[model samples]
Target: MKLVVAYIRHEAFEPIRLELLELGFPSITIIEVKGSGRQKGITEQYRGSALTNYLRPKIKIECVVADGDTQTIVDTILKHARTGSIGDGKVFVIPVEQAYRIRTGESGEETLQIHPDAAAAAT
Candidate 1:
């Protein structure tokens, strides 16, 4: 399985989540986060004065899915999150050695029962 981590602009969270659900990725975790990229935060004008922007608010969406669905998931996130500007955010994929559904004691890929084809496609 692969873990897809997406850090996106806060405003785009709801839209991205809806898009993900439409693409069959509904089991996800969303969290509020703060960070900056190459541009390093941003500067804004307040009351006719420039205010230093050190950290920006962002949303982090995480989900584990079948490897075969990796490309689709990434594409979906990028398509929905792009703003044609800086701080649109980024996506990261990592291998997940294990997972578990605490309620049922289901483990590993079984935890991600949402994607039924993951195991079959893995081999």
Candidate 2:
């Protein structure tokens, strides 16, 4: 298994979420975060004074998927999150040595996807 983590421009989250869903990746964790990257934040004017905020707001999207699904998931994030500019954010693929679905006590790849029965029930 692998964990795909992406810190994306906040505006990019919605579209990214939709595409990932269309690609059959329905389970992901979303976190509102703030960080600095190569772009290093922006300077703005307030009360005629320049203010520089070093931390920019971002949306953190995390998903654990089967090993074979890693690249496709990363591509989906890249396709939607790229703005062709700095601070479009970063995507990291990390090794997931294990996973366990707490509610169902399921482990391995079985814990990564919404079971067919559970999905149908939600619909």
Q: Which candidate is the best by TM-score?
A: 2
List TM-score per model, in order.
0.82, 0.94
Q: What does the lDDT read for residue 86 in candidate 2?
A: 92
RMSD of each: 5.8, 1.2
For each candidate in the order shown, give its overall lDDT on alpha carbons. Answer: 0.84, 0.92
Candidate 1 displacement at residue 43 in angstroms: 2.6
- How many pairs in model 1 have backbone atoms within 3 A of each other, for residues 3 or more apart or on separate chains, i.e. clashes? 0
- Indicate the TM-score of model 1: 0.82
lDDT of 1 by residue, 1-123 (tens): 999999998888887789888887888999998887875956799999998787888899998998888898898889889998988898999998888887667887767765445547856
lDDT of 2 at 120: 100
Q: lDDT by residue for model 2 over 36-68, one digit each (tens)?
A: 979985999999999999999999999999999
**Deviation from truth (RMSD, Å), model 2:** 1.2
Off by over 4 Å in 2: none
Clashes of 2: 0
Clashing residue pairs in candidate 1 are none
